[model samples]
Target: MKEERLFSLRNPWFVVSAGGTALIAILSILVGFVWLPSVHSDFTANGLWGAICSAAGAPSSWYKGGDNVADAPPSNVVVLPPLGIARVNAVSSGRGATLATQRCSMCHGVQSPAGVTAPFLAGQYADVIYKELRDFQSGARQNAIMQPIIASLSDQDMHDVAEYYSSQSRVVQATAADGHDDSVARVLSMQGAPIRNIAPCAACHGVLDRKGAAPWLGGQSAPYLATQLRSFAAGNRHNDIDEQMRNVARQLRPEEIDSLAKYYAAQP
Candidate 1:
C-alpha cells in the first residue's frame, strides 16, 4: 500500500513533476530549433549586426572605399578641363599621342584592329581615366594586363595618357539586339530600380549630372560594359569607390545587364 501510494499517477507530487518535465521539453525545442535560429536568421538578413562584426574584425586602416588609409601614397589631384573639347591643346595632345603610341596603342587604340576587345579610351572623362590608372598602379584595382603597364608609368605619364584619350572623339558602335525590353534599361538608367535599391546610372555616369570621377558611358562598347558589370556582380572587380558598382551589379539580372550595356553602347 505504501509503494502504491508513492508511485500513484494521481498523487499531486507525481503530477507536478511530470508537468514540469513536459514544460522543460517544450521550451527546449522552441528555444533550440525555432527561437534561436529565427533570431540569428533575422540578424543576418538585416545586416546591421553583420556589418558591426565585420567592422570590428577589420584592420584600423581599412577605409570604406577598400583603400588602406595609412598605406595610400599621395596622387596628383585631377581637375576637370573646361566643358568643351576645345580645351585640348596642341602640345599636351602631342605629348599624350606620343606616349600612347609608345605604350597604350597596342591594346587600347584610336582605331583598334578587328576583334580587339579592349575598352576604347577615346572621349572618356580625364578624371575617370586618371583615377583608373591610379587605382591600377596602387594595386587598389587588379588587372593582369593593366597592372604591369601602369606600373611602368609615372603620375605625369598617366595624366598625359588620360589627356590624349579624353581629347579624341568617341565612335558610337552598333549594339546587337538581344530581344529584351529596352524600356527596362532605359528606366534603370534614368530612374533606377528603387525596389532593388539601385541608383540611376545617369546620376554617376553624366547623362543627367556628373558625379566626381564618374566616367562618360555614352559611347562605351557593349561587350566591354557587359563584361565589367558581370565582373562587378561576381566580386571579381572590387576597386570601385565605396563598393558602389558591386552593390548595383549584384542587384541586376542577366537580361538587365545586357540591355543596359546595349543601351549605353548605342548612345552617342
Candidate 2:
C-alpha cells in the first residue's frame, strides 16, 4: 500500500492530473468565477520555479509557522545599535568610509562625477542599508535579479558597508522642480495636512540622529522617490518585511508623495 501510494504521488502524469482536478474543485468551491486561491507562503518557499508553481494555485504547501523557513524577524535592523549624531565626534576619521568604498562599491559601484542606474550610496544610513542588505540575503527581499548578488555576503560585510555610507557628507544638487511652489511643494515644506502630524522630511531623513529604517533623502532623485513611494502604496513592492514602508507610503495623500519626492530631490 505504501509503495502504491508512492507510485501515485511520484508519477508526473498522476500528479499533474490530480493538481488540475484539485484546481477545478477549488474554483467550484469559490462559486465558479474562475477563481483561484492565493498562493500560500511557507517555510519551504524556494526559487522562481517554486514561486511560479505556488502562484499557479498549488494547495497544501504550508508548514505550521507560516514563512519562518530558517529564522524569525529581528527586533532591530542592525547587528549593533546605531551610533546617534552625538557619537559622530568619536569615530576614527574616514575609516568606516574607506571600508564602505572598498566593499560596497564592488556591487553598488562608485560615482564617475557622472551618473548611472545603480544608486549612489554616499551619506545613506548604516541601519537602513544594513536592513536592505540583510533582507536581500535572507530571502525577505526576494527578487530574481538581486537575490543572488546579496546571498553570499557575510553579516560583517553588511555592517561595514552601512557604517561607511552613513559617515560620508552629503553633496548638494537641485532639480528643475525645485523652483516650483505648488500644493506638492507646500506639503514637502511641511505646511499642509498630515505633514503636521508626521514630522518634517528632515526630522527622519534629513537629520543627523534619525533612527529606524529610514535611508537618507538628500540628493535622491525626485523621479525615483515618486515612483518608489507609489510602488509601495500600490503593493508593487511587497517583499519588505512587515511592509512598514508600504504602510508609510499608503498614509500619504497622493499629493504628499509627489511633494516629498520633489522636496528630497531639491535637497543638496
Candidate 3:
C-alpha cells in the first residue's frame, strides 16, 4: 500500500479545488469590503478598515462621539429632554393661540377651507408638533415655508404653539360618504408586513402602542399623507428615528401608498 500526500499540487484535482476556493474568497472580499462601502459617502472617509467593518454590519457611530469630532460641526439636531411631555397651562395655551393665529392659521385653520394639503394642526399631539418644529428649526427637516416660520420661534414659543393646537377640536370628515374601500390599508395599518421588516402602523401611530413622538394619522389629509410616504421612500424625509418609517415606505408599492393615505384620511 502506498501513502499519498493529499495537499500536494502535483494532484490535479487538489490543485483545481484549492485554486477555485482561493479565487472565490478573494473576489468576495473585494466586492463586499472594497466596492460596496466605497459608494456610501459616510464610510468612504474611514478608508479600507471602515469598509471591511461596515460590510460586516458593524455600527458606524461607535467611535463618532470621541473628542476629535466633538469640536466638529453637528450633522443633525440633538433631540433629547425637549421631546418630553409638555405641560399645557392657560398662559401657555393663550400665548400659543396668539402665535398660531398670527403665524400658523392661514394654512392650518378653518378659514383656509378644504382642498388644502398642509397638515391640520388642530388636535395634533403636542409632542409630535414640537418635534417637527424642532426638526424644522434645526434643519433636520427642511421646508421652505416651515423653516422660515419656525426660524423665529424660540423653544418655549414652539412648546406653546404645539399646546394651543393640541387643545383645539379635531375636524372629523364624513369618511363613509367618501366611498373608498380600504381593507388592504386597514390590514397594513393594524398588522404590518412582518416578512418585510415593517411594523404595524398602529404600533407607533396610536392604537396598540404609542411610541414617543409618533403622531395619530387618523383624519390627516390624503394628499399630505401620500406625499409624505413618497418622500420617505425617496429618502427625502428622514427625521424618523432609526429610519423606521423610511424602511416601511420603501417597501410599499405606489398603489399601496395611495390606499393607506386614503384609509387614514377617512378615519374618524
Candidate 4:
C-alpha cells in the first residue's frame, strides 16, 4: 500500500519555497516601514492633477494650467509614524521646568513681551507649546516648517520642551480701532474694494481666543504675515476653521499683498 506522505516542510523543495516566501515577506515589510512613503507621496502629488482635472470637468490631469510642486515639501526628508502636527499630552511636569527655562528662553526672551516676533512665554498653557513644537516636527503646522531641526528631539524631550513654552505667557494683542490708520486698518476695515466677498481681517482675529493658540497678528513680522497669507491662498496651509486667509489671499493683488506686508511690519 502506497502511503500518502505528509507535505513536509523539511523537504528541500519545501524549504526553498518557504525561505523565498519569508524573504519576500520581510522585504515587503521593510519597504512598507521605510520605502513606500516617498513613493506614495509622489504618487499622491501626481494624483492631485487627476483630482483637479475632475474638478474642472476635464479629461486631462493638468489643473489651472500646470502642476505645482511649489508648496509641497520634500517628502523624502520627512519621517513617518508620528509624522503629523499634533498637540503633546502635557507640558513640563515635576522636573522638566528647568530644561524649558534654560533652552526655550534663549530664543524667546525671558521677559513678558519675549523677543520681537517670538511671543512672551511667561504664563501661557503648556499644551499649546507642545502642540506647536510637535506640529513643527510633524509638518502639520506649516508656518515655520522646521522639520529636521525639531525632528531631532525625542518624544520625552518634546513633552518637556512644549511644557516649558506652554507655561510662558503668549502675548495678547490689543486693538485701539480709533487710534490711528494704516494698511492694517484698511484691510481690517474693508476700506478698499471688497476682496473675495470677504470683510476685514480684523472682523475675525480682532478678538482674542479664550481657547489659546490664536497667533498674535499685530506684532508678527510683515514677512511672516505675508508668508502665512500666501500659504493660505495656495492651500498649503489648512486647519483654520473659517479659512479666513484662503479667501482673503485669493482676492489680494500683488501690490496689495506687499502693502499689507509693509504695513504690519511697521506696527509697534
Considering every candidate listed, which one attains the maximal lDDT?
Answer: 3
Residue 110, candidate 3: C-alpha displacement in angstroms? 6.4
In candidate 2, what are the lDDT values of residues 1-268, reduced to their tens digit?
A: 3444544877888899889999988876564222222332221224444534545666335577856564334323343346443233325325445555555566454331122223556666667777777777776554575676556666665665666666666554445656545655545444323312234454545454454676776567677778777977876665444565565666566767877777666666
1 or 4, greater by TM-score: 1
- lDDT measured at residue 126 in model 1 versus the true structure, 0 to 100: 78
Candidate numbers, best lDDT first, in rank order: 3, 1, 2, 4
lDDT: the better of candidates 2 and 4: 2
> lDDT by residue for model 1 over 1-268, one digit each (tens)?
4454755687889889988999999997677556755755422332544434543565324346865434223234334644233344667678778888887888787543222266778878877887888888987767888888768887777777788888887765554533334887999899986635689999988768887777887666678889999988987777777678888998788988988988887777
Q: Write the per-residue lDDT of candidate 4 for residues 7-46, one digit (tens) a residue.
A: 6765677778888999999997667445654554322232
Local distance difference test, each candidate:
0.72, 0.57, 0.77, 0.52
Give the lDDT of residue 75 in candidate 3.
25
Return the TM-score for candidate 4, rounded to 2 decimals.
Answer: 0.45
Which candidate should be chosen as best, given TM-score against the real structure? 3
What is the TM-score (0 to 1) of candidate 3? 0.68
Candidate 2 or 4, higher TM-score?
Answer: 2
